[model samples]
Target chain A: MNGYAGKILRINLSDHTYKTEELDKDKALKYIGGRGLGSRIMAEEVPPTVDAFDPENKVIIATGPLTGTPTPAGGRYMVVTKSPLTGTIASSNSGGFWGSELKFAGYDLLILEGKSPKPVNIFIEDDKITFKDAAHVWGKIVSETTSILAEEAPDKAKILCIGPGGENLSKISAVMNDINRAAGRSGVGAVVGSKNLKAIVVKGSSKPTIADSEKLKEVVKESRGKLKDNGVTGQGLPTYGTAVLVNIINEGGVFPTNNFQTTYFDKAENISGEHLAENFLIKRESCFACPIACGRYTKADEVEGGGPEYETIWAFGAACGVDDMKSVIKANFWCNEMGLDTISAGVTIAAAMELYQRGKITDADIDDGLSLKWGAGESLVEWVKKMGRRDGLIGDKMAEGSYRMATHFGMPEVAMAVKKQELPAYDPRGIRGQGLQYATSNRGGCHVRGYLISPEILGLPQKLDRFAIDGKAEWVKIFQDLTAFIDSAGLCLFTSFAIDGEGYANLTNAVLGTDFTQEDILEAGDRIWNLERDYNLKAGIDPSQDTLPKRLLKDPIPDGPSKGNVTRLEEMLPKYYEIRGWSEKGIPKAETLEKLGV
Target chain B: MKIKVRLFATLRENRGKELELSLQDKATPEDVIQELEIAKSDVAILLVNGRDGDFSQELRESDVVSIFPPVGGG
Candidate 1:
């Protein structure tokens, strides 16, 4: 347990009781902690079909062995629970100082179970834990909640909390940490809201012991050097942040615009990363032990805060047809303040706009002074506020997410989502492997599950013809498996821009004292993937849900370089299933599960 | 042939955003980059009319050639 805190902290909200248990060493070795270990615990302890908001539904907040260690960009944690959004197992990740602080507090995982009768907050200091009444801050925004909680906690305590978005149980609500960083997907914050828990403040005095400090020192130096030398991580990211992808994606003509109706935006330059850096960037931010400062803090008018990442920009700017960078920045700020996932919130608004465009939603259906017209930048911030609070009629329905809202309007097809959760910036029609990855992501339409965009578009590790269908299934499987490992190992996915599978293994080996080969590391990733897939299968996420929207699969892009192209998902899915050792129906074969021991 | 060349990220610094480069017929993206005075290594991704562009492939009239430095994000 050299790299682990070696304890599990379980808090029973119903009875206001807590306990500590030993970490399961065997499970840790197989799952590699964080998302992997959290998913295993969810499947074993919680029924797959349980309602996400049920008192019995549990949330497992976990950190990997690499977390809190002297490893490059090893400051990440996973919030694993059944998603209110997709009904599939959701493991949302965030980077900041909280995960590492939890390790220093002597716990590898925190299991929160049952419902509290009243709003409450949990405070932890090293070995001490207390549950304090949080009725005073129950409906507050994220920054306000953090500041209020910080007043009573120890000096330098890190706070993780929900906002009005979660309090109202918005399906797209996010868990905000370190004020601006978010575990922003799959409605995880709603689970916390259901438990009547408002926030958790933690301060730890010690760090996890590294098995081989000397080896870790060497590994750290090498990885940092690699990250520094890499182009995307070293230069592009630090200089322009993740927002740099705007112009690149737009130039490729795969940047989703107008709710995916078109593949390119004529106004892309007005919202490009270069535009943001030149106009509004206040500073660059970095996570613990991260060399690539890809985070951005910006100001617009009177608002100033973190983010408006590439996806956020696309969702609010191009997807909604709004090219005003200032409005997009403000929307991003409101999203963080309201504790809502920017991708989900912005895309949900885009879906509403589509509904309006088709006459499904008329002016009579909207509140006064609100317009659903495309590129309505002035009303974007107001819509975000309503969505977070579930205010008025449209806000209440939108809080349920685009899938439900669109279906209510008798056109679920209008939602640009896979498995109920909205897709991110990249339209999959032009990027074949990315399409397959989106269709098969465990937690729904998530880009990070398997960012095929790297090899497909960025020319990293060599580029592929973005429209090619051959061998894409293999690439999808490998990227998905590797991503699962990185998410579980508590490292930033951005590190993969420089570090390969073998490099990841070396870093883990130094800290954990385990000599795992590159293949072994991949196998571990494959195991994690299967475990999530199995849980989703049992949770009623059918193989049929493993497909993109009809629009993306059938409708050709009307313009841009990707025009005349559609996602050849049908041509690649069966092959993907074969490569994954799943049946034609997308069920994992018995032998395949046995091989991975899932 | 009149090829529209778009520069992005750091590549746009002194080069400006979009430029109309008048070149001889049969010129490729390589010629376009050379005209812009950008190093080949600086061009991590190049697109012609929204598709992956080959440096030596012949360009067409009204082709939109977009060039980017090493840039990425999800």
Candidate 2:
């Protein structure tokens, strides 16, 4: 238990009951931690046939060994559950002070089960965990509820909670920590609300017990130096945050303008990182133990909030066909305060905009006088407010998310999604690798799952020919497996840009008192990925679901660098199956599963 | 002949947004980058006239050249 809490906190909100279970060391070693541990626990305990919102379904909050340590960008945590949006297994990660805080509170994972008879909040101070009535703060937005909890709980306690978005049961709802950082994907927040739990606050003093403390300190220092020396992780990110990706991606003609209809956003620079840094950025923020502090604090006119990240900027900018910086900034702030997932909400609005432009929807069809025209700043800002409280005529449809909304309008092709989850910022027509990544990601259309853009665009590790689809399957698999390891290790994925697998193995070996080499650690990553795939299979999701949207496959980007290009998923699919040791249909083979010991 | 050379990310930090550079008719992207004093190692994606072009690809008159560094995350 040197590097872990070695215990799991189980909470049953049905009757306000709770218990602590000892975690097996063998299981921990095999699964590693964070998402791997969460998925393993979910696979073992939860029945595949149950509904995502069913009381029997559980939400697992997990942290890894490096959390609460001096490792660079190591302060991270993950939320694993059956996704309300995609009905797939969901593992969303977040960085802030929360994960380390949880580890210090003496728990590795918190498993929530059943539903509360009434609204409540979970409070943890050392070993004293109790339920506090949250009926009064229940309906307030995330920030208000957070401040209220801070006032009621210990002065130094950290709070992770939801807002009206979750309270109203929006599929795009997110769990907000430290006021803004989010485990913001796959409707995990809705699951938390279904349990009638509002927030969890923690205050503790226990540090992770490391096996080689002195060595860990040295490795941590060395890792920090690597981060400082890297450009993307060090200078670019800290200066412009993730928004720096806007102009560069736009120049590549992969910015996903107007809901993937085109691959270029003409006014990209208007809402780019350079613009934010020059006009609105008031401060730069970082998570616990992060050296590449990429979090930006912004103020525009009278509004101030955590700055819109690259994905959010693209979602409200090119995805919606808008490039007004102030409007996007306001939407970002409003989304955080409302506990709404910016990607889902902004993409959903963009989907509606496409419908309106194509004559599929009319003003009469829209409730109120709200216009959803492209490049209309007012519409984007208003939609975020409407979505938070599920207001007006668009409320129920918006709450259903983009895929269902597109289906209602008979334009599912324009949904710009895979597996019912809207795609991220990158337009796959230009960056072929990420298109494959979106199609194959277990958590649906997500970027972080397997960031193939690093090679195709960013050229990290090594650059690849973005136009070629020949070896992209192999590259995507490697990145996915590698990313899985980083997620489970409780370290930031950005670290990989600086250190190799051996560097990570050194840190793990020092912390966990294990002599495993880099290959051993990578094998665990492979195991974790296969376990997740296996869980999805058992949950009745077929491998045939591994595909891009029809628009990505059939329609060509009309102009720009990747003009007349469609995602070559057909060529990569069989290759990816071969690389993954899966059957041609993309299902994991029996031998592969057993090989992973899943 | 003149070519529009666009710099991005860190390249923009060293050089200005864009400069119309005078070059020989057979000038390649490499020649343009060298004229701008940009290190080849720093270049991730080089586009000529809005198409994927390598450093060795030949440039044309009035053709727009955009050079970018490797930028990842999300």
**Candidate 1 docking class:** high
- Candidate 2: TM of chain A? 0.99
| Share of reference contacts found in each model | 0.80, 0.46
TM-score of every model versus the real structure: 0.99, 0.97
Per-residue alpha-carbon lDDT of candidate 1 for residues A1-598, written as tens digits (9 for 90 to 100):
8898999999999999999999989899999999999999999999999999999999999999999887889999999999999999999999999999999999999999999999999999988999999999999999999999899999999999999999899999999999999999999999999999999999999888888899989989999999999889988899998888888888778999989999789999899899999999999999988989899999999999998899999999999999999999999999999999999999999999999999999898898598899999998999999999999889998999999999999889999998999999998888989999999999999999999999999988789888999999999999999999999999999999999999999999999999989999899999999999999999999999999999999999898777889999999999999989999999999999999998
Pairs clashing within candidate 1: A561-B50
Candidate 2 has a DockQ of 0.54
Interface RMSD of each: 0.9, 2.0
lDDT of candidate 1 at residue A125, scale 0 to 100:
95
